[model samples]
Target: MNTKTLVSICSPVYNGEDHIEDCIKGVLTQTYENFEYIIVDNASTDNTPSIIEKYRKKDSRIRVYRNEKTVCMDDNFNICAGYCSDNSKWIKYALADDYLFPDCVEKMVKVGEMDEQIGIVSAYRIAGRYVTSMGLPIEQNVFNGAEILKQQILLKLHVADGSPNTVMYKKSVFFEFNGFNSKYNQSDVELVFKLLDKYKFGFVHYVLTKSGRDKKGGFYYLVKHGFHILEYLDFGYKNLSNYKSISFDKDEMDYLKMYYARAIVSFLITKCAYFEWEDIKRMLGNIPEDIKKEVKKTFVRDFPKHIIKYFVSLLRRIKSYLRDKKRFEQFT
Candidate 1:
């Protein structure tokens, strides 16, 4: 792996004063040195700009820009993608709240370089205390892009690993697809599906990134921004089936129905718990009537276990809170 292919690390941040420095440092200290770091401050009214400058002055490879007007998450991400250097062949998103391990870029690039067809390279991530699930086990090291798209449609890959920040993609693929879709706030997952339709994916078995989540901000932001989980599922189901490259068999369609059923039910419960009826009504108003009916049907079908799991999840959160409080007290 002596080749020095230029990699562009882009981070689109808003009010990220708390973690922006660490994110920039993670990029600066990457074991792979031939890279450029771009940080887009989306009118952040915090110390984010200054912190970015603190490192920018020290490193010639770092570039910082501030947007005149704020933008949505997807738009912000698009801006980040637009900042990639023309010579950069690879684009890696380093979210402001996430930290990358020293060799993350090196290993991911290694996998991508293994084959000219590899469009995206991703690794297992160590999620902080707040992740809901790690997703279904992908036992293989390299996956056919189309097959992984099928897996995603079947909801077998339904968990946090689909994050764009955890993966590196070929710059050509990003541009060819016109980057992430802005219509869906959860555009990252959609982008992955589209990319997989055309290119192969390389999986690094090691955990190379540390991802963090906020318990409250997670659901609130999506719901407020009109990103319903049901829409994501419905969009994915339709998008994958209609995708010209991938064809699903009868067996796969059956499994897809089962997965969609479970997914709808799970989504309903989470949304119901986190949002008020008014908020759900306002945000979900555009959802089709048939999809709404299916949501109800699935909720009724899974009511018993849904209740049990809801309580169990609540208890787990309480336990986690207590454990964290005790750890903090120890430091005090």
Candidate 2:
């Protein structure tokens, strides 16, 4: 009798013909073989569907599903997850653009089985050339989810939450939390934060997955709209009450105030074109009124100093440009 834990691996793809084969091969070649590979194509108009079908024929473990209509990415993710076998103990998301190391599932499952309280398991991931999610201690493999969540909020740790591709979720815990929130673009981050608030976190200190770091992907979208920092701040603020042991020292509070102030100013200066007023208002809505007022006050008090610095930098750039133009004219 094969007694190993059954795992369900899912890949949600849309126009992913470029990397779907690699993603599939990563799963098919997993060192741990007792698992199902689910591929949900989000109505891809390209060769993605055919590529998936090619693999499904070769491997009976591969299951393919197609959406009649292309759904939002978050919705598609939830739809993909919904197809997991009820008998499976864990759900591992292998993003269409990202592939796993051969031992990825084996390693993540080993850590997860170490503790029943561990609701999420994460490992280091290669983001481009650098290994990321590195704040955890070298020897420690498990953590109190609340403490990890607190540290993550305070910017002290980043081991527990990251791209779905880098982590595995307890099947029960995932459904208990109702999966991803379709309303937020950063729903994966949001869901991980929510999970860490009430459950233990497990970490495998190995680089198990490679992130594609697509410049046109979700992270870039968040950064382009200036929603990345604000969304994180909003998550931190909303979860503060849940971390009863967490307390901010005066310095930390001051730093956060300045950080919030700078984010607001930076968004206005650089990201205004990509954001609507309503979108900005909604992002800021989750943050507390007191913190909002404090940051506004901080921004007001520091406005003149900021203006002076901006003018000085602007003047220097203007001088450099004129000097360069003069040098070119003389050469001509």
Candidate 3:
């Protein structure tokens, strides 16, 4: 990588006062100097704006923005990307709560330049303090989108554990795909699948990002994150066949089971059992009798837990909605 190449690293955070400062610190201290660091304060009600302003003045490369109206995670991120320098052909979207390894960006940019067809380079994100996927590390490999996507679906793994923070892409390639679709609250998983057609992923294979979990205020965030999972499922199923995927084309039975498993698990986590039952029914409707029994068996094994969580989330949503209604009527 040339030392003179300009780069951009950014994230959009809502009420992210806690990590905003440290996140900027990590970027400013990066071994690479020819880059701009940005933080989009997406209408944070908390002290996040103040923190960002402090850093903005301290470093010329550090810039910040606050959305006038609150934007969801996906839209906010795209807004941050829109601010990247016009010369920035390589772009990155890091998380408000995640910091990169000192050399992460430098190395990825170098690798990106090495292969022009390589649309994105993903790396392992070490969970420094978060409980994600495997309670382990996720390493996204470097390969053409089609072959890697086959492995992703067959193993049923979120490609690179399914978050954009652990990856960097050619800015043009990402924008060509229209940045990211905002129809999903957590659409990054589906984004990987869609990108497979035109982009080959390059892997750096090191733990280059650290996501710190257990932020000070976590309870509400946990619920929101759970709900985001459903948004992901909605996107995945609606566009399932649209993805330019290289299917292994195993028996139809295996495909059926996987489809069922994906839906039920997503619904169970987001606590959207009934809301998503239509999708599950459609999937089950096409499967063999034996496969149906297996689905039932798998679902039954943890029936009690899923039921409890689903009802809890449903109740919470109901309560929140009711409270909002009461407040809305008073203002009107």
* TM-score of each prediction: 0.81, 0.85, 0.72
How would you encode candidate 2's per-residue C-alpha lDDT over 211-287 as one tens digit per residue?
97778888888886667776777667545665554667878767666666676755554333444776566545655
Ten-residue region with minimum lDDT total, candidate 3 = 131-140
> Each model's C-alpha lDDT?
0.78, 0.84, 0.68
Cα RMSD (Å) per model? 5.2, 3.7, 9.1
- Quick one: best TM-score, which candidate? 2
Q: List the residue pairs that clash in candidate 2.
A: none
Model 1: CA > 4 A from native: 1-3, 130-140, 158-161, 219-228, 265-275, 279-332
Error of 3 at 52 (Å): 1.3
Q: lDDT value for candidate 3? A: 0.68
Report the lDDT tens digits of candidate 1 across residue range 221-299.
Answer: 7655446554565566645555767787877765666665555566556668776566556545554454556566777
In model 2, where do residues sit more than 4 Å from their true spots? 242-255, 272-288, 300-332
Estimate, for each residue in 1-332, the C-alpha lDDT of model 3 and write its tens digit: 65576888987899877787777777777786788887888889999888888878888988877799897778888899899999887777778887877888887887677677888777667665543333112444356777766555544544454467778878888788877777754466567666766678777756677776454534235333344334333444333466655543557436645665645554454445446555445444544454456657667676777779778988999999999999999999
For candidate 2, give the lDDT of residue 122.
Answer: 97
Best by lDDT: 2
